[model samples]
Target: MKTEKFQTILVSASILGLAIMFGCAAFQDAIVPCYISPDALDYADANATTFLPWTTLFDARRIDRFMDFRHLWIQAEDNLQYNFLKGLNAFHIRGSEELKTILFSPTGPIGLAFPALAGGALGTYLFSKPKDKRKIAELEKENKK
Candidate 1:
């Protein structure tokens, strides 16, 4: 019984992990339009107009801009492609005026961990549920009586 339970857990984890990984990959591939908040644009207008490329691999918290860590491919209003490795140099995209819409493409592992972690937790909960055969037997006995 213990071994069966363990096997169930292991299988569940593997299946869930693979499903989450693939599902997230597919979800990322789906093109979704995003709009920049007006406040953010106002801030950008006040500051420098030029901004970093928002890619899937980009971690806003990371201080290092030199690192090639972008996962998504960003196409700015200028119809230019920007990746993590190549910083927007001559092409300037303003947040207020020139800024319109981006052809957001997920080229790398962006927002992948969330689904994987969530799926694993769900799988553990589902597979670890005890199969109460005794309860069923008791129910059957009560029905007969």
Candidate 2:
């Protein structure tokens, strides 16, 4: 009875772990479009115009490299900011102050949940015992015999 219970618990935990992994993967995919849109470039361009004069301090080659580097840096920063705003917009769209609190607040559970849930799911999947271990062992023993 105890062994049966243990098997049930293990199966349930494994299923739950897989579900969490899939949910995390889906969440990541959903946010990717928000990070990669051309609108992010427009946002960066508008913000970077303020700092354009700083590039003039360098020679042409150096100025070119600096602008290239600066543009990439600004675009990356803008994408991050836009993704955050997109998440906030999603929360507002859902009419969920709960998600806003979870995502926007410094003490939000999302900070802990994302890493912990992902880690737990990965650990469970990688460490779980194979279902056919005994069969393989028996085959090996027969081969040896």
Candidate 3:
């Protein structure tokens, strides 16, 4: 909780700093000799590198945190490897966070597919009929006697 508050403060401060810089740049000629080339308030460049990198950094940090181990359990819940033969639902999940982050994230669309693919491959090997001759012979004896 404390960490979340700190992160919020840090993000707010960064955005505040960016707004101040943009406002200053818009009419910087009054304070400085040279005028801005395209003008900061021109909205023509709302995504200007000057103010955008700050937002981008914050966005990336948010995604990176979401993609970390804590949220990994959410993605693992539907995984065949995690559930094994337990059916569709996971037996237990040990993670906590906002659903918006996990559900609305940039990678959310396909995030589930990768784990499902991997787990399906693992389940295929684990649950498939035996390829080994020794195991095949052992199975063949069961119906005979």
Give lDDT tens digits, candidate 3, residues 5-93. 99999999999999999997764533332223333323232332333333333333333444464446656875756568554333233
Tens-place lDDT per residue, model 1, 1-145, is 9999999999999999999999887755233323344454343332212243342222222222312222122224234543532455434534423333332223223345666778999998776444566777789999999
lDDT of each: 0.49, 0.64, 0.56
lDDT of 3: 0.56
* lDDT value, residue 79 of candidate 2: 100
Off by over 4 Å in 2: 1-58, 96-145
Report the C-alpha displacement of residue 125, candidate 1, in angstroms.
Answer: 99
Order the candidates by TM-score, highest first. Answer: 2, 3, 1
What are the clashing pairs of model 3?
none
Report RMSD for candidate 2: 43.5
Q: Which of candidates 2 and 3 reaches a greater TM-score?
A: 2
TM-scores of all models?
0.22, 0.27, 0.22
lDDT of 2 at 68: 74
Give per-residue lDDT, candidate 1, residue 132: 62
Highest lDDT model number: 2
